[model samples]
Target: MRIIRTPASIYLFSISVIGLLFFTFLIKIPQHSDWIVMFALSGSILLLNYYTILIPPKGNSLSMDSSIYLASIFLFGLHSTLLVLLIYSVIFAIIQRKIAWWKHLFNFSVYSLMIICSYYAFILIDGFTGPISVKNIIPYLLSICTYFSLNLLLVGVYFVLEATENIINFFKEILKETTATYISTLVLSLVLVILMKPNHLFGLSLFTVIAFLLSLAFKQHFNLFKEISEKANKDFLTGLNNHGYFKEILEKEVTAAKENEQPLCVVIMDIDDFKKYNDLYGHIQGDHLLQEFGSLLKASSDAANYIVARYGGEEFSIIMPNTDRKTAYSFMNELRKKVNDTYYKGVEGLPYGCLSFSSGIAECEKETYSVSELLNKADQAMYAAKNQGKNLVQLYNGHSEYSVQRSLSLEKELEEAEFQLKIFLSKDVYTYRHSKRVYQYAVDFSRMLNLSVDERKTLILGALVHDIGKIEIPRDILNKKGSLDPHEWEFMKKHVTYGKDIISTNKKLEDLIPLVELHHERYDGNGYPYGLAGKSIPKLARILCVIDSFDAMTTERPYQKTKTFQEAIAELRHCSGKQFDPQFIEPFIAMIKEFETSGDEQHKEVAASIVN
Candidate 1:
């Protein structure tokens, strides 16, 4: 036999076993008096079951079958309740042939279990045997409590196992919808059970009519609740989730990412010159444009399983899960190009000459583990995109450095940095590798320190050639794996001055000279060449000191033992006030923490086991 032993199947089998065990307790079949009462109650349950109002993608539906079960139990006990529901469910299953066989079995078993648990609870609580009396309130309360508790537990377990979701959070989410329904079911059950004890036929008939009316009321109430929820979550104009709901989902996604060690990306977008387009077209057409863009975003996002929302007027966000930053950048930019090419009448009249937008992207693994931090980075990237030019997609690269207004010229400058590092490779291969490592560390740390776009550009480029002057020293001395003598050490110390002089020759690259010269300066004023100390050290240079030493500790060197990332961070913390600037330690720690868990190719094998 082909056996399916998945979580769903196992759960169904377990519950079915319990239900079958409950059936064994149905030995005491009721007499004529029970049948007379059960006949009307059975009909009521069957009719109510057929008229259930369903919730989407689930079996959470509104039905008055609980009152029938309660009334039957109060009248003739567990055996009668089981007998009534068994016949009704079988017919219900056959009538609704669309339901799978296992589902039908599961449904029947759930009801059987509920009745079993509730009946025993009622009896155990000293419930009266004969008539429904005020003194039997304890049993009624306990029974109602057991029924809902069992229902929640059985379904909750199935969902938790089937979906692999958090147990506590799943309960909280379901409670929002199911809490009131359970309360109403218990109250209605109590009323019907009491009335039926006096006259079975009349009470059952009255309850049936009352249940039909209640169903109508519940259907209307549920409809209204859903409508209200829609309005609250969605924007009035664009129909996208509003900013409030966006934050809600962002927080949830952050939690999920942290729990699963998965990556999440946030794409923040703003329509370029939208106000001008709106001004030229008027608010009526402007609203239409917003609607059109929202529709475009919704359609584009829906198929990708992204949560697209209107962050505010003219601004929007797309939250993507299990996506890397590189993939997210491509996706957002492709959409940006599509929007630019797609024509809106008045959009062409704006400066960009189309429906263009600026977008910023940030991923969870990029020093932005929290929702607020991710939003801030993504938002900054979006504005950086605007500053560079509209119709651009910018990934938050620690600092806003990549948003170079003069990117064509910036490209030329990058070639120079690469050229300097390349030339040094011939003289000392280790300096080449060391510079590269320092540059990469600065990239992550620059973002953590929130350096401005210009400063980040300078730091990244400077770190690349900070050791270029070491090329002038003898190759034998550079490659020596022992401590440097006095003459060799003095000669090596002159590299900073040599690098500064080399960088000063090019006006475009001159901003990096301070970083090249002052990176070795100490807070306590005992650094090389010049005894520059404290605030006297350039800010960029001070920032570079922490990162440079971090890279040195991480990578193998001729003199010092290469330290783990943790050891290096400790070294930085221990020397904070004396050697390194105290202000940069914490942010550097944050950046290193990001690198430890990051999936970035650079993070996999740092010269630096890392920190606590």
Candidate 2:
């Protein structure tokens, strides 16, 4: 016969034993006596047994034994039966190690022998000591205490063994199959026993058998549910929470935040131009990139409070609770940088020589809006990033009066400027194309250097209008066929300050002024404008300097033919740390290579010309 080593089996067995003893006591009440005390005692015993079994007490078995003894003293009388029971129980426990058969036999023999011994001892003691009634009462009370104590000891041992087995099984399978099954079986058997004839021995036997079966069923069902839940929540590709489960958790967190008055921030991110990347590199490589990006997010964020989820295809979101905007921004910035730094094999010419993404962040404020509104705001911010340019971060403060007015004013101005700028660039088609190309290069190079999205956006916008200063110079001078004289060169350099002045008055475009003014500043403090060098130059200006210069050199102008991509990169390499920030040069070169091979040659060529 197979020996049951499972916790469910032990728990069921112990419960059955306790139930049987209590049932026997209930049935043995004399017909004439009030059944109320016995009924109350039975109820108390059942409750105590349930408590012990359900939440077994901590520490040694002795405490459980004492409790059992106390309960027994109220029921059975003191006699030799108690001693006999205790001795048999100890002996049976020792010998019933291997087989269930022997253990059951020991259990039966111990209880039966103790009962018989108590009856005989009570008779003998009564005859020797005094009147039967008084003498018998003391012996009967003693026997009752001993019987309960021994029963409690047996039950406690069984409970401990079952609990240990269940814990072991839980570790082994992770799914609580045995536990669920046991619970279901126990509940069903208990209900049936309560409804059945209490005096019938068959009812008692049937209850024990049914309870054991119920326990096994409960464990199996619990394991099944656990397996299903794991499959439902886990992402197959990256082993992270899937989008559906992530949303579920986010909703819960949102409700919790509302109740507790805590702030919550959500960040949504997507790989910029991922479709182009996938088209260039195959789906397998694309999948690999997604997996890598997910892993990077997981590693960078705090696992305790942050929920990182695969929001969708090539998109991910992090839900942070109890975090303010500034901290949320910093956390996202770090995550972005870490992702940009990740290396991939065979892929080059993209930002970081592998992949890059754009992000939008929104924080929940007290009384601002609902969770849905926060999510919508984050989505809008993300789209704004895509609109401004990719590979950036956009934060949504959400529906401020000042911002709404500012946005409306900027929208009108941008539309007008876009029209005029288009006309101006078309008049000299090369100028418009060149500016656009340089903007791309600047954006890519800045990302490669791990610059913040705000900085990258500034660099790209600066690059687009970097030569806007040239608009003021005569067209003949701007596209001059021969090298400029010192006087003409002086006139050309004025475009930097001119462009800066043009954007300085516009509040929306004010941030772009520093880029325009300082893009020409050299690393050695030798360039134009303020001649700021080294750390004095804004890092954004340093990135713009290399990108613009490379675009100017590689693209064709009236005075010069286009240089090869390699030639442009080599020129930038030689000037590292002197004309450009030394740190940015390698990444810049890597970005150029990535773009060139990835069929973004037109953009690269246009950038080269603008730089020159």
Candidate 3:
């Protein structure tokens, strides 16, 4: 009903119904002699439809009714074919009354259109109702192709109008999924035409029986495939999803969350003092305890649509989509309390007595780079919970002691990031110098903002390596004397992704991924790779963009005319809110002005170095 309610869909459906009636009565009608054969063919279609083959692996159904219809068209001509369709549609509608009445009528119309067009095609190509012959091969192919194409167009358009599928992808998926099945149908129809030419009723019966048998065989194979696939993805002891399958689900959910701009949380939990329990109760009892715990986790989270997985050893993980860290912490804390109160055999010997676990929650943020990074954060949080006694729930805090330690290692990490940055010196001296200038600006701007020590360190390190992705660009494009062509410009834009990939290789530098990948993002949502807008862009990335762009505008390049510092500063001011964030522009401009007015020896030294 919803599908037919749309104007385009209603028009298509109405035209199809009108076309079917016009062709059935005016253009063609079954002769008195055609009644018996029509009934027989209709019966065969209903029987074949009931016993459709269940294809293996994906369990897609393959109906042999199309082959029967094609064979009827080839053997009995247009009038008998239409009569048979009329009988089959009426009988199918009666047997399938649970389906909506409009759906049944729409299906009948679509089939009628396919049969009418295909019959015309067969006749136009000099096809006749007779025994198979080599001379009629072209007609057979053309008519069957017409039937298939019209089926796709009519049905696919209805789905597209109803908002059920994307048109291009719908066609592509249908062609890929149905090609082999349709080919088999074409061959089977030809065989049926050959058999029915000599003895119509007997040939239909034999083909129907064989198809039914094959359907049964394929159904068994499909069942086996599903059985094996289930076992493969399930853990043996706990019966939850295994480590590999959990990762797959996490990756898919993370990607979906990022695209939909929804929150996702991952919680890593470990059974507290499990080794001590195993030492007191032996491995067999430990196995039982794990099974009980796994069942408890499944019971607790399944109602909320959380995916629970065994993360190996005594650790378990839960993927909670559309949940923030605070909600995740609350859910996990309640579970932790429930677990602590629940009694298990041999638990009295463990550290806290009764069953207990520690959990850590990490919410996927706008700047969270990868699933691995998310998991690492949760794993760290879980460990932090464990360090603060056994039964506890902790949320990941970016400014926690771990972050302080990371900041303390800024000098060492900066040295490593610079070593990577130096690769650009050989590739593009302009980019190398540009990165260094941005780094200096970041240092001054960070201090001016009075940011936290960790913030200062991260901002400085991020600016230093923000353009490290440029190393992947071809030197010719990197140093092109003229403006890059559109394709070259698009290719150059991939540096951010390349930089993210490069930084992700080293886990310690993963914190800088947002800045490296998002520095090109604009405040107004017009930039790539993701067009993140306004405050949604990370603050460090926003600052880095200001520095990166100002340096790019002022610094010398072979490709375009350069602007002076004063001109670049004016341009920055003019583009505020549209390109640069308004809050940071004046402070940055002031920093540059202070350096210029000071007539600093450092500037002269840097100028001398560049000239040399």
Candidate 4:
């Protein structure tokens, strides 16, 4: 059978075996009675120390080492061993002054004094009764008291010194040095036992051996426990944190946030169209994508208070304690763009041109709530994003009529556009693709302006079909190689009226004609058609004008060189409030700056190409 090796068990076994051997020798002593009593008492003290070490009482203030010393002192009589203990205590006290040395000294002194007084009282009683003499009684009492008092002081000092010595040695040796010191200490104690003869200093030798072995075993057990804990808490796949560990930490953070009345934000993200990618590719590629996404999350939020966890499967959760809603929303927006921009070229047939993810964010309030509630809110938001159209971000702020309407509108448009663009682009590929880019930018800028559902949908569809009239403009004029002359320029302007006329035929699209027609209208009222000025221009039209110009400036035009997204935005800003409504321009510019600063080149490029 395997022995259950523990510090206390090992120490007890050693003491038991040693005591049996000492018992045999103790019976042969000439002063058998006195020696037997001494041996028995010593054995009892050792047994008591072993019991305390194995099953220590709860709330016990004494350490195992201190208990061992106390046991040793109790076993040895004050008359014979008092001086030795006193000297050791003094030395120990001087060496270790920080471990409540004064308290130990006082306790020892009081106990020793009590023992001395008791011994004298017994002598005085004997003297008054019969054979005891008073002549030596006073001197004996004084000598015994002095001896025990000194011993108590030394014992106190030893405890202080030992504690201090351990601390100092630990710092000097470092972790690597501990093993050598332990081995050396064991070997030295064994050598000393052998040289001094265990039969002579049997009690001291046995105690030393038991203490050393027990300490070593205990240390090993603790180390094993620590190693297991670290492995259990760490995530094997992402190297961030496992789900179980994340939950534990999140609970603690949430509790802290609530107690401190601070804000805590959580973001839940999942790969968009992940199942499609998996079906198209293999599980191996899916795993690789997950790993890449995890790495990106880690790199993006390395702040001390930020935590990222792989909640499970393809979902990840981020916790930002003490972060307000606005800040958290901004962070999630940037994170969404980053996830969308992450590309894996090895995968095939992805529409967004890469692996993309949708994110939902929820912030915690001081009201009684749990971390799970926050996570659930984020999950709901993520589903909302996916439902509206994948690869977007949604902030959960409870339910609202406006939010519901917007979600429905976005869903309808996504489905319709996916089908319509396929047919339209197949006929005239350039016009179809350009219209898609314009729609995307229009939607983005509309959301940035916090437009209502009706306004956003109007802008989205109007921009998408704004150039639909080009189909009738004659291919030569539409794709003209040089600048348009007077007659051609006038004909070019006819597409707006043509687009309006076509859109007006559909009741659903009738409201969008104004937007389509006025997209060419300038902020300064210097534009074509009506020349509507300032607020007189339809809000959607004013927005479309800027986005349309931006898309044209950045895209390769028939007669103009394509400009970078930044350059196009800069040119737009130069004409803000003149060519664009000043109110919308600030938010637009802010959104552009945010996108650029996010370090997502693809998103910036996408925004620039579509808006120009």
TM-score of each: 0.63, 0.37, 0.79, 0.36
Worst 10 residues of 1 by lDDT: 603-612
Tell me how candidate 1 scores on lDDT. Answer: 0.80
Please give, for residues 1-612, the per-residue lDDT of candidate 1 as tens digits.
999799877878988877767776663566655665666677788888767654432337867888678767776787777878876777787788998887887888888888888989989978855566888888888998898888889999998888777788789878877877777777777788777767878877888887777667767777777888889999999999999999999998877886677889999999888888778879899899999999999998997899999999899999999889988988897788778787877776988677888999988852232476578668778988888877899888744644455333544688777776787656776787788788878877777776767667778888888887786778878888889999999988989988878877886776677788878989899997688778657778888898888888887888888899899989999999899889989888987887677746674443241211
Report the number of the highest-lDDT candidate.
Answer: 3
Writing each residue's lDDT as its tens digit, candidate 4 over 541-609 gives 788887788778877778788999788878888998788877776677676677678864654455356
Q: How do the residues 236-274 of candidate 2 rate in per-residue lDDT, one tens digit apiece?
A: 887678989887888888766765667788888888778
Best by TM-score: 3
The order of the candidates by TM-score, greatest first, is 3, 1, 2, 4
lDDT of 2 at 227: 71
Candidate 4 clash figure, as a count = 14
Which one wins by lDDT: 1 or 2?
A: 1
Model 2 residue runs over 4 Å out of place are 1-209, 387-389, 398-612
**In lDDT terms, how accurate is model 4?**
0.62
Residue 271, model 3: lDDT of 94
